[model samples]
Target: MMITNNPPVLNDTAILNIARDVLDIESTALSELKAQLDENFVHAVRTILSCKGRLVVSGMGKSGHIARKIAATFASTGTPSFFVHPGEASHGDLGMITEDDVMLALSNSGKSDELMAILPFLKRYGTRLIAMTGDSTSPMAKLADVHLLVKVNKEACPMNLAPTASTTAALALGDALAVALLKLHGFNEEDFARSHPGGALGKRLLTYVRDVMRTGDEIPSVVLGSSLTTALLEISRKRMGMTAVVDETQKVLGILTDGDVRRLFEKDVDVRTLVIDDAMHRAPHTISPDALAVSAVQLLDTHHINQVLVTDEQGVLLGALNVHDLFAAKVM
Candidate 1:
């Protein structure tokens, strides 16, 4: 018998059929998990919520990969959690687990030898165990304070030997638990933003108008009685492409932009003779100093304007910002 290195040829239809079969199997498994949800899930959620210390998620093999992701989700959402390998737990790593902590163990068969090794220690330390397993009758499940059944009809693998559908089921169940805890704890977007400070979500939630807007002398402005030429000079000097027309008290009366100047020129009107108020838009778009920078982006995009004035409730001009500023701040 000779073994060749040639690869097997597969048509697009055949490839698509195989992909669909895998998806169908996983989808069915998820449906089964959904139908199996009962008071046991509620008990698991209650156990996690009641825990004073962080959640310690442990697993081995493919289940360990899912465990790490699930721990990440829990940590980012609201519940503080970290992953621990059961094999490593037998070593000094078990010191990471505390009495107040709750253990979420994942195993398809609920009988992983490595996991079983830590069961006695977990019990002796009074650490609550929440088991996610396929077999509710298995030793881990029987010993668990709360059992989350992630049983699947079969693996998506052709040989039904590798962990496929079971892992998917575990991941989805973990997500479900995390989301439920998030809702119960009233973990809003701001809380989530705090945990994820370096992402786009943080930029949107944490970056405020005051943080990015130009203040004091940086703001381009001209008095209400100032001439169009004076406003134009301010706009050019500040390079904001616009200037605020304000009263003596520094209250925003109107806004004059390069576009307004262009319109004045298009009408063949001599801008030098016109006052700033004559060419200014009285109903200028304004944002609060406390508003999110993302809101400013929306205002500029919605009004199709390049820049907007930042003002207080009484219409006092405090700062100014342009689309370029938002882009520089990564809020755009």
Candidate 2:
């Protein structure tokens, strides 16, 4: 039998077929992980949840990379966690682990020497261990208080000897565990935002109008009977594009903007003697200082307004915001 040296030329269909095959194999592996998520998985979750100290994840090589990602996901989602390289653990880093901490060990073969070498110390210290391995019968699995099996029938690599399929399976399992732990801990959006203060989602979830809006003395506010000139000066002084026209009780009665003054000029209205009420737009829409900036964005879009007055529940002026403010805060 002769093996053909010349393989068929690749085509779009062949490329798509290869991609589909890889996805199918990985999908099958993930389905297997889901099927195998039994009582042991729940036990692992319970152990981590009940741990008084942080979750310490330890692994070697490729498993170490996945372990670090898993640790980050856990920390950002509400569970306190950090990753520890097994090679370093024997070199004084083992001091980082405590009886209060739970160790999550990752090994494809369940027999990494660096990870195994510290097991005796971990056990002596009475620290709980959760093992993730491809082999359920391996020593690490047997020694662990809880073992999560990430078994894959074959690798997605064409040579059938790489970590592709196994790593994908492990990553999916780690995500599942993190989501489960999040639900178990009742982690909410606010909690997640607190952990991620530098991102867009963090700003959206954690930032209230009060945190970003120009407040109090920074606001351009004029009495309800003030002249349009005074209102314009207030708007210019505060640079908020508009001024809130308030009554004697400091309750917002209307809003005066450069646009309103421009309209008065176009209609030949007296600018010098015209009170703010004569030139003001009454019952202008307003937002609460506690409202989400995203809500202010929606209101701005819907009403075609450049600015909105920020008020308390009793219609008292508290602050003001404009599209520029949203832009400055990156909320836009």
Best-fitting candidate, scored by TM-score: 1
C-alpha positional error of residue 106 in candidate 1 after TM-score superposition, expressed in Å: 0.1
How large an RMSD does model 1 have? 1.9
Local accuracy of candidate 1 as per-residue lDDT tens digits, 1-332: 78778867999999999999999999999999999999999999999999999999989999999999999999999999999999989987999999999999999999999999997789889999999999999999999999999999989998998999999999999999999999999999889999989999888899999999999999999998898888889999999999998898999989999998898899999887989878898988999999999999999989899999999999999999999999999989
Question: How much lDDT does each candidate structure score?
Answer: 0.94, 0.90
List TM-scores for all candidates, in order. 0.96, 0.85
Q: Model 2 over residues 200-317: C-alpha lDDT tens digits? A: 9888887778878898699889997787788888988998788998988889999988887777789997788877777787988999988889889999999898999999899998
Please report the TM-score between candidate 1 and the true structure: 0.96
Q: Which window of 10 residues has the lowest lDDT sum in candidate 1?
A: 1-10
